[model samples]
Target: MTHVVGESCIGCKYTDCVAVCPVECFHEGPNFLVIDPEVCIDCGVCVAECPVEAVYDEKMLPAEQGEYVELNARLAKQWPLIVQSTEPLPEADTWAEKQDKREHLMEMS
Candidate 1:
């Protein structure tokens, strides 16, 4: 199973998870990141690396965040690959505490 990046990552866009991904499955977007389900090795290392707990195994994804499974797959194709850790958004700390930020998700890198 692949790990999914959920709405919690919408504004925060932390790259901690990306650095730990051995398969370079993570994709970079303007305000978020997504896992390429087809490339993910399902190692689970990236899950704990996410400070906002945004990454989850597909099967363990919350019911309410179920859409992220497909979202991750779709977005991964459009976004650029991110294999290194980088600074998060300017308001990452503030955004990390907020929930339901799906509406803030940006589609561009």
Candidate 2:
């Protein structure tokens, strides 16, 4: 199983999870981060590191957020790798607790 970055990470884009990933599976986008399923070790370290609770194991993902599994996998290959923690997007705190953020997800880094 691999960890998926879901809708909650859309506009928030917190990098805390990236900081703890041992396998460097994280990829950075304009307003989100994704996990490269092929590289993820499934260690679950990123789940707790996400302040917005955006990361989840494949089996643990909410039914409504199921699309994120493929989203993360697809986007990871298109975005650049993120091996270190970095400042979140401006107003990240304001968006962190907001729900239904899938529409806000950006496609570019």
Candidate 3:
């Protein structure tokens, strides 16, 4: 199984997880990030690195956040690979604690 980046990452776009990823599984979007299932090592390193607690093991994902598994796979195919850490969006702090932000997700980078 792979780790998935959930809705909590919709606007935060924090890349702390990316920096610690051992594989090039992360994909960058306009204001989000996704992990390519095919490339992910399921290392679990990204999970603890996420400041927003957005990363989760596929099986451990909350029922409400289950869709993120597929969302991450689909978006990973469209977005570019992000192998390093980068500054988060300016409004990251404001959006970090917000819930159900999926509608705000940008499909394009």
Candidate 4:
């Protein structure tokens, strides 16, 4: 398993997490940031760097936020290849509170 980003990261789009990620697995989402499961090393660096506390490990994530495991994995597969960075900020603002009304997904996972 790996770490995941949730609701707290929505419109926040801060790049603090990206700066600490050694693998640079985080990517710029239309609104928020997403982790690349395919490359994430499960180091948990991004977790501590997150200002809003939006990052969580797979095992620590709450039951309600579990779906984020699949969401990040699936989306990462679809995202185009990007140059990994030590700290990259999100580009757009597709986030709005609960963009998809699945705000619970932000609680832990």
Model 2 C-alpha lDDT versus the unseen true structure: 0.91
Predicted candidate 3 versus true structure: per-residue lDDT over 52-102, tens digit per residue: 999999998899988788889999999999988999999999999898898
- lDDT per residue (tens digit) for residues 1-109 in model 2: 8889989998888999988888999999999999999999999989998999999999999999999999999999999999999999999999987888888888876
Please list all clashing residue pairs in model 1, or write none if there are none. none
RMSD of each: 0.7, 0.8, 0.8, 5.7
Q: Tens digit of lDDT per residue, candidate 4, span 1-109?
A: 8888765676666777776777768766554577888788998988887766779988888787777788777766665433443332343233333444464333222
Candidate 1 ranges beyond 4 A from true positions: none
Off by over 4 Å in 3: none
lDDT of 1 by residue, 14-46 (tens): 999988889999999999999999999899999
TM-score for every candidate vs. truth?
0.97, 0.97, 0.96, 0.71
Runs in model 4 with CA error above 4 Å?
A: 80-109
Off by over 4 Å in 2: none
